[model samples]
Target: MKLCFQNDNICVYSLKDWVKLRKEYRIIGEYLGSSQATPTLPIKLLPEEAIFLINKNVAKLIQYPKLLVEPTDDCFKEYNKLQVDLQQAEQKIYKEYRKKELKPYIDKIVIAKQRKLNDSVSTSSVLNEELNRMKVTQENIIWPTLTEPLDCVKGESIEVPKSILMKRTTPTKILVFTDLWEKGYYVTCGKKFGGDFLVYAGDPIAFHAIHIIRCIEDPLKPLHTSELVAFGRLGTSVKKKSVLATKTNETVNYITINWLDL
Candidate 1:
């Protein structure tokens, strides 16, 4: 299978190829459709995703033409414009909320203004300061993405996703991810569930995360009993196993904590 690298993700140009890849290799992404003759299948993938596929030789990278096609001046400019527009819109919303928040003061100010006094000036001053602070935060919030992979980053023979590593994914997390992947488990980020990963025994479409694993470099090390209790409760509530996995010399040990809710 071949994947065209672009927009910090890989694209399988044809729908047929996308279906084949997903059904066979479990490659998942957005099924973006276009109004043109053929629908565009744009798949969003993480840096490790592409790297893992390439490393396993299950898929091929088609990042040719040293100059990337997207993420040009126009793309970034458009994205920034969208961000600004969204910020301004949200600002209007919060401005309404702020008015409601200051309703009592606003009523007092309305009476003061009617009486031709400057008592409301201080309130206006504080409100304006807060609004200005909000505006400042909304400016220059850059979204890190691309329309296609650029030629600047590549290894000796293939494209390397340095951004993923730079994002500081710990070696332990990566090790656990690859280990589960090799064993036919579909692993995804489980930070929301207070675990390193959400492990699915089968395709996510067919099954939910059957286990939530918190990766530990050393299991013998002491951990808070409260943490274990919380993790176990969460897993039990979700009908999944709460596990602590420790790796040693490429071998992982799983210690399952079952909540005996008697």
Candidate 2:
């Protein structure tokens, strides 16, 4: 990612490295500020004066980072403070401008302003109603679901509740198979397929059964295997022309087990 600073100089760094540096340096202003150049100061100002000027400009640059991207706590806090300052400054500027440029023009125009103030409403009841409305709004807000669908497939056996699976309108079953003869079976399977089948398939029989079922059913369905496990199914103990095994250091190499060994 290219990080451009206030001086208009850009530095290229990996996203991870940039995040680390941003946290370490607390350079939220540099990241969020507008690309447009600011009015140049004619002479070198005192340190305090320079800081004040920079702070004002810094407020203008304050923006929240992408929600998907994680920023440090300090960066978030600084960004929030700068945002608040920017809003206040904007309001103040607008108020001054309106007073100077708009108030006189409005004053010259004849206007009949009728303010209809409600007298029947009690202040305490209004406050309570507003508070209740705010509470209801907060309660109704749906927070984002944190869990990723792919996360259910990546590493370790995931024991999904039968009840939950049954509740789905179209429940999908993922079956993973591995050859015991293959070296790094669990790692390879998990890396490729991910999920419960990789971890739970302890013996050749279980693995063969799962694979046989998958080979028969997978082609009939819309479901597809991950890129890592696209080599189709494998069998156990069966030695057919389709099956081949090479041994190196007592570990099995790319062995193609027959699909019919179900």
Candidate 3:
């Protein structure tokens, strides 16, 4: 037997004995008093309401009188189950609304930023040199090399010298491509599987270089106005900066990558 809070306001009983009340009474309002009665306030009961309340309360007490005496493990378990069920229902409702209402706005902002990047004139160095003070040797940089090269539709690859590779022990490569920027797409690296390498062509090199320098300058505060503007230029809006800022407290160690390795 269980007590259920139904439709946010009414309480329902699920015992064989309690089920007889439904057959004995017609409308809950006739037995319980005004089906529209608010749950928080006191109810003005007629004779029928008083009789129904006394009978139900007495029956519940008789059946589960121990529950009225003290809190029990079974009672706690039931309470926890109800709480979990309520939370699950709420999360489902929120997720549905977020996908339908919020996602389209985010996509629109991203598209607008991409258009801005496409329209702007290219700059050799968008990031200031002072910001690039942190340097790592090729030997120090980490390179996740590719097992097989992806078929390149455009641009030619140049040989990366071993001398450049030996300069830093851990080399991290940022891949940039002109076509992605020209088409108004934000370039993101693929997942770091074993033996994956970075590659970039034309303007993407400049963007990737700026991103690396930014990562070095204040790795924690990676999303500065300049970075936001860069993203905006590429077609993404900056609304999520505040949310990201909250997460920036988590520590991230620097990993260096040489341009040649990509």
**lDDT winner:** 1
lDDT of 1 at 61: 66
lDDT of 3 at 136: 30
lDDT of 1 at 257: 94
**In model 3, which runs have C-alpha deviations exceeding 4 angstroms?**
1-47, 50-63, 81-85, 109-262
The digit string of per-residue lDDT tens for model 1 on 115-234 reads 686444565665675556655234343232333333343333344454443355555666777778778887766777888788887777788989998999776789999999999999
Quality of model 3 by C-alpha lDDT: 0.30
Q: Among all windows of ten consecutive residues in candidate 3, which has the lowest summed lDDT?
A: 238-247
How well does each candidate superpose onto the true structure, as a TM-score?
0.52, 0.20, 0.23
Predicted structure 3, TM vs. truth: 0.23
lDDT of all predictions: 0.66, 0.30, 0.30
lDDT of 1: 0.66
Clashes of 3: 31
Q: Which candidate is the best by TM-score?
A: 1
User: Cα deviation in Å at residue 86, candidate 1?
Assistant: 20
- Candidate 2 lDDT over residue span 118-195, tens digit each: 234444444333333322122232222222212322233222222332232111121112233122232112222322
